[model samples]
Target: MFYRIITLKTTKEIWQTKRSESNRILGIVNNVRLFGTNFSNSRIFQKLLVIITERFETTISSLENINDLSTIILAELLNAL
Candidate 1:
């Protein structure tokens, strides 16, 4: 019947609309997850840099000249190698 056809078309339209909306929400969720991952990585890198700088400053605080600092750094690098 005509009424049955109209009802079937409306139901199909509604299902399609819901599918599109779900896809859009999924895209937003993926973007948020990527942003969270990048933010956490940035925070970790920043913390590591801070720790390294603090330790280096403390180690070199007693040095009076560039030559002495360079010598210490070279020795440390050589030891690492």
Candidate 2:
């Protein structure tokens, strides 16, 4: 049915949006990991954190939507820093 098709399309769009957001968050986390200790002092890293918080309305704790691997990596990086 047309309604079912529309619902499926909407679901796909939502999934894509979540995927994009997760990728963006993962990239930021990787960058932080690469910076290591320097990340805590870097102005750019601070800005990225602000952006993540403000734009995504997400904190490190709220990244449960991301995959397990990325979540683990982020957790390790957080611990390291």
Clashes of each: 0, 0
Give the range of the ten consecutive residues with the poorest summed lDDT in model 1: 72-81
Q: List the RMSD of every prediction in angstroms.
A: 25.4, 9.5
Q: Which 10-residue span in candidate 2 carries the lowest summed lDDT?
A: 63-72
Cα displacement (angstroms), candidate 1, residue 62, comes to: 64
Residues 1-81 of candidate 2 have per-residue lDDT tens digits of 223235555777756655665577568756767867454333443455466544434443354334333224443424322
lDDT of 1: 0.40
User: For model 1, what is the alpha-carbon lDDT of residue 51?
Assistant: 37
Model 2 clashing-pair count? 0
Off by over 4 Å in 1: 1-9, 38-81
Q: Which lDDT values do the candidates have, in the order given?
A: 0.40, 0.48
Which pairs of residues have clashing backbones in candidate 2? none
